[model samples]
Target: MTSTERSDTDRQGLSYYPWWLDNLADDATLEGAAMNGTARGAEAVRTIVAKARELYEFQDFSYADVFGDNGFLEIYDSSIQGEPLKVVVTVTRNAAGQAQDLAVLHRPRNSLLLFSRLMHEKCAGTPLAAHFLSDDSKA
Candidate 1:
């Protein structure tokens, strides 16, 4: 789609999906992209799609709850190597109906470990692995 069409569709909501996935996929990428100022810019969008492809085998996100009219939680039933992962993504939007912030919360134990393992495999040499790996200095 053209940039204008993309922007219009993003204004609709598919735009936020990538940022949500980026939060799940790689923190460094998200931070780096965010450095450019706008979360919905090209760098962030590319990172989101790349991370989604790298990490999740399949994902089905549905509206779990809505707070008032501008905030909501989206629950993702995702699979990695056939294992189930339940992730809750919470988002807050501005008055103009644009997302302002997003938070991703993963289920404990099995799901967290699965995500870490995927991060280790996918992120390897990247700084994003720290988001999953424990701090060695604390030991």
Candidate 2:
């Protein structure tokens, strides 16, 4: 599909299945402002994303568009625990159109910390927990 068409679809809101979900490369990586380090592998990325989404009370995308040949960007406003949160997500795909890298940036340090702490709590006892702040840290 063309860039314009993709943008239009994005504006309409993400579908039940986002394009990148099934198209992630086996070695895809996820990194973000709230994460302590990058999470690698498609399964790990999927798990991390699912957990993160579960924490969001709501999300409203302000901008979602394609950039260059294999780059997609999404900027959205969301809330977690009734606090306002803004997120910028960028995905980079391989030549075959499989997502290779997914990066998320969360704004407002307080919100980020809250989100990170929540993530840490939820991911505890799992390998994903290491990618988030330790429970001992101040949220």
TM-score of each: 0.52, 0.86
Question: What does candidate 2's lDDT look like per residue over 46-116, in tens digits?
Answer: 88888888887766676677898889987888888989899999999999889999999998898998999
What C-alpha RMSD separates each model from the true structure?
9.8, 4.0
lDDT of 1 by residue, 1-139 (tens): 3335445434333444444333332212222211212234434434434664466655555545567787767666666677776666666655645555555656555655666555545555655445443423121
List runs of model 2 lying over 4 Å from the truth. 1-17
Clashing residue pairs for model 1: none
Q: Evaluate residue 114 in candidate 1 and report its C-alpha lDDT on the 0 to 100 scale.
A: 61
lDDT of each: 0.50, 0.83
Model 2, C-alpha of 15: deviation from truth (Å): 5.4
Model 1 TM: 0.52
